[model samples]
Target: MESEDITIKPADKGGGVVILDTKDCVEENLRLLGDTSTYQMLEKDPTLQFMERMRGLLEYGKERGIINEREFKYVRFPRVPVFYHLPKIHKKLQKPPGRPIISGIGSLTANLSEYVEHYLQGLVVCLKSYLKDSIQILNQLSDFKWEEDMFLVTADVTSLYTVIEHLQGCEAIQYSWQCTLF
Candidate 1:
């Protein structure tokens, strides 16, 4: 497969791999990455800039008593994030789509992401629609009374992370944080 100029990805629905021409994969990925409203081209690496901004934010939080000195020190430095995607072979489009994944596992903001996730975990699980896993969906569905005229539908939000307005998302986090405090 490597010698033939192809790309391989795990299937979106089934437990197998989907292989496609490399050119087609590149084109599909580029189409998603080319959206100016969600993404922009950077001439230079933004790693330093990102680190500086994170330090400033952490320092401000420390000063405001929102974050402790130790926490600020530990969360200051962030490594670069890796971006990749999985092919959505289940979709019946002319060209198969890709689901963009920005893995923050070892990135500069990884620690911050983990912190926020930990803070929100309890509250999130308590919500009405929260499901620990896809299998849990069956438990919820079982409680529902099925009607002949009604239909069960599921929807997937495309490029959900990229399309979210930064300020609005931050405001939402802030709101959720405040609600948890009281």
Candidate 2:
């Protein structure tokens, strides 16, 4: 296919590339977004609203002395996030499927998100199930005391990304944060 009429994306599973018809790529993306329970089509961009909400949250932090004046001033409105997809070539679908990716590198709440992640990093690291990398897993396996009846198992949650609702996610964060204080 000609470059102009095709879209090139990295494969979701193994390392490689998948070149697909641009129309097909667009349709696949739209189909993923068409999941009403997970996503909704907005008539207008929500950048301004998001920026304002972020500002209000920051202002509240400032008022409560949770944030200093310098930090409040330093955190400015950020650019909106960009949405794209990587082709899930490993899937056995009729048409080429894609995994949606909403990049929030410079989005309105990006800084706040980064701050929250940093704050929670300590707790996450201390969790018994936390795995830093494949090497860590290998180290654990090397020290494992296997029993005759015991079987090692692994699992992959395919729908993990779309399974949790936003409110549920926030509640989970809040719960984690509260638990950390004790």
How many clashes in each candidate?
Answer: 2, 0
Please list the C-alpha lDDT of all candidates, in the order they appear: 0.78, 0.81
Query: Which residue ranges in model 2 land beyond 4 Å of their true spot?
Result: 92-94, 159-161, 177-182
lDDT of 2 by residue, 66-166 (tens): 99998787665788788888887777444667788899887777777777777788877766678999899999899999999999888977568678888
* Model 1 regions more than 4 Å off: 1-4, 92-95, 146-150, 174-182
TM-score of 1: 0.79
Candidate 1, 9-87: lDDT as tens digits: 7766663787778888888778877878877899998888888888888889999999997787667466677766677
lDDT of 1 at 148: 94
TM-score of 2: 0.84
